[model samples]
Target: MTEFRAFHNTDPPQLLKLWHAAGLGRGAAECLSIDAFEVLIFSQPYFDPNGLIVAVEDGEAVGFVLAGFGPNEEESALDYSIGIICAVIVHPNFRRRGIGRELVLRAEEYLKSKGAMNITAGPSGLLSPYLVGLYGGTRPSGFLLSDPLAAPFFESIGYDATRSIRIYQRDLLGPKPPIKFHLVNLRRKMQLMISDDYQAPNWWWLTRLGRLETLHFELVPKTGEGAVASATVIGLDLYIPKWEERVIGLTDVFVKENERSKGYGQSLLLEIARRLQDELITKLEWHVEESNTVASHVALAVGYYQIDTGIVYQLVSR
Candidate 1:
């Protein structure tokens, strides 16, 4: 018989095992450890013990659900009144026993108790409190889309894919096609500058966890035209299960609204790539969201082809 109970801090080892079995906690040789979990997730301001509902069978943990809400001030931005189901994983050995569904049901109830009128399965849209840490990004593929079990499982519970994102992977293991950019001209005209160890505009949750070393580039105006564009390469890939040498995830390039269309964003991207290539980073990945047409175009131009697409599922409370 399977027993359901609230998760405790001591359950990290079991949960980490479950994450590995479920094909999660990637980018590492080992799954999240107790200390890692505390730094990556439990340290969040919105983390609630009740949010982690686990299932135990014969004293061995089998499955669990993690849910949470955004900060009060950011409710409007994230549909805070509507809770988020960050993750739901069941061990493969214990599959097809309704364990997954039960975990979600309990997660919804926990969110309802928090005054949520509706619930979203994951990052359906915008920045969310879901899938942080090793899976961190303002917008990433939904946890469900990455897992074969997640799609059908969520549908069975009335959750549907409200949004889908295209995940592009580039093979840096081979020689990269050379690309041209007017970087020198831009630097003189727009005062574009590149600096080491760049950080992005702070987001509360991001500041607390999951930040890796990255490069920062920005446009400083010479004519006092104000900021033109700013981008940062955030986070490293293949850090877990051992580290991938000379590689990093290419993310978060922002060109000011008025400054867009001059190829600033793309210029920044290629420049970052060139800098990395010089340092022997042969593998680079550029992730593009469905709505980010500019970045999407850049990904393709830079020889990145479609490898995987991720969908964000949502369930409105009934």
Candidate 2:
């Protein structure tokens, strides 16, 4: 017999045991440290304990799932919700059971109760369909992909795959040819437009991070024209406190279609490195669509290496 319950602070040790037994130690090690998981549960904008479910068999936790609920910035009427099956480990001795599915169902129930019209899992990048349906926006936290079996498991149960993204990292201390482009210094001008009362779906995250003194921005001039054609926003995220103690994170960088091949993206990245280097930052990270060849080339030329892959999955109530 199997039963599911909410995850508690005291479940880490048991959870870790299940994680270790499932041959997922490396993946588990990266995201589920005792301290980090605790912080994730408490630090997120909407973290309901009732949304985190654990599957138990014979009084021991065999699987776990986590879900969060919040308002969708683009679709104010539809509450935004995310359900992550963070750990769905079934003891090697107890494989082929329906415990994982039950845990997922419980998580979905919790999210629905919070007024969520859709639920997505895996990586935020793969959740675009859900985001587009729920928020009418494409912004995702990151990209991730589930295992083949996992993908089918979700699909068989109603989840669909959308897009996948790869996480890339660029080492800042490497020797590279100087990037040449006309730089339009817009820090002072841009700062003037920022305010504590301004709110927008796309800019809300930026505004919140701006309040922390970690947000930075640069505007690039359009090629063949003096007008601004692109903008880049960078910030610092303390997600992985150990591996990336103070890494520079690329918040957003957009180049107009007409601005292609003008080196605007390259210039923006170089300037970001130069500015952050002045402050002693040594690492920079960003996410790129796996299908975007242009962006991939730019990233590679700038010494960035593909490190991790993630997907964002989305679902909307029909």
Candidate 3:
């Protein structure tokens, strides 16, 4: 008999091994580390270990599922939930036993009990009605499963592709900023631009949730004396629990249309790297719209490599 129970402190090492065997990914591997797991359990407000369910058979853990919810800024309600099925790995020996389905069902029930209005799962490409039944409908930015099996499974269950965001990373050690470009710290120059009248406050709040610091603004010069130019805000988030190699996440890099192709965006990124390198950060990471070709090109020009894709899905409960 298979029994599903809450994940406990004693389970990290074993869970890590299971995740490794499932060929999850770098992010999952990083999160599964014993130290990382402890930090997530204790420090993150949205995480609940009791919401993490593990399946055991004959005294060995064979499968697991995780769920949680957080404040929905869009709705201004604390009851909004964003359920993530961190992983649902079944021991190879336990395949074809219906264990995965049962695990998902239990996870969904747990989320509902916790007052989650909607649930999101990383679906295998293979079609499965059971997976689709979890949500009233697939969210606008639903999670994407690269695995051949997982993709169809989600589609068969009713999840559809809404949009995809591409993750990019750039190494800072190789190149230096161009000498001809003048780099100005926008944070000091554009204090007037960040007005309460605009959505700057909302952006600032969201950046805080992502643990970002060092918000910088940039301006591009235009031809006429009275002509208004393009502006952008670049923010950085430092990853915590400082390891041997520290990294910085560049979140919300935006530029106005008038400034395209003038090298301001690239210069701003270079300035950010130069500033943070003194602090010992070796890598910079950010996400961009997959469809934004110009932005993608600029990122590539600045030595950023497209690494992974993440999709966002939204669900509204009736």
Candidate order by decreasing lDDT? 1, 2, 3
Query: How many backbone collisions does model 3 have?
Result: 19
Which has the higher lDDT value, candidate number 2 or candidate number 3?
2
Better of 1 and 3 by TM-score: 1
Candidate 1, residues 1-318: lDDT per residue as tens digits? 988899887888888788777765332224346666666667766677898999999888899998876544543233457688878889988889889989989889898887887677764334456454355232345753445566777887898777767766566666565645565567566665677744434464354323445666776677887567776565454243344454456555678888777767666665566666776665565556688787788777666776556667778445
* Candidate 1 vs candidate 2, TM-score winner: 1
Model 3 Cα displacement at 20 (Å)? 3.4
Residue 303's lDDT within candidate 1 is 65
Judged by lDDT, which candidate is best? Answer: 1
lDDT of 3 by residue, 58-170 (tens): 87888777655544555243443445453467766776687877776777778777766656554211111112211111111134333334444444444455556666777
My TM-score estimates for the predictions, one after another, are 0.84, 0.64, 0.62
lDDT of each: 0.66, 0.53, 0.51
So what's the TM-score on candidate 1?
0.84
Candidate 1 — worst ten consecutive residues by lDDT sum?
A: 24-33
lDDT by residue (1-318, candidate 2, tens digit) is: 878788776787776666556643211233345554444343444455676677887878877766664435553332455444433456667666877677777777776776666567653532322211111011333323423345555665666766667667777776754444342343222211112342334533432332333343544233333423333334343234325544566645666677668666665676666667777677777778878888888888667787666554555442
Of the pair 2 and 3, which is ahead by TM-score? 2
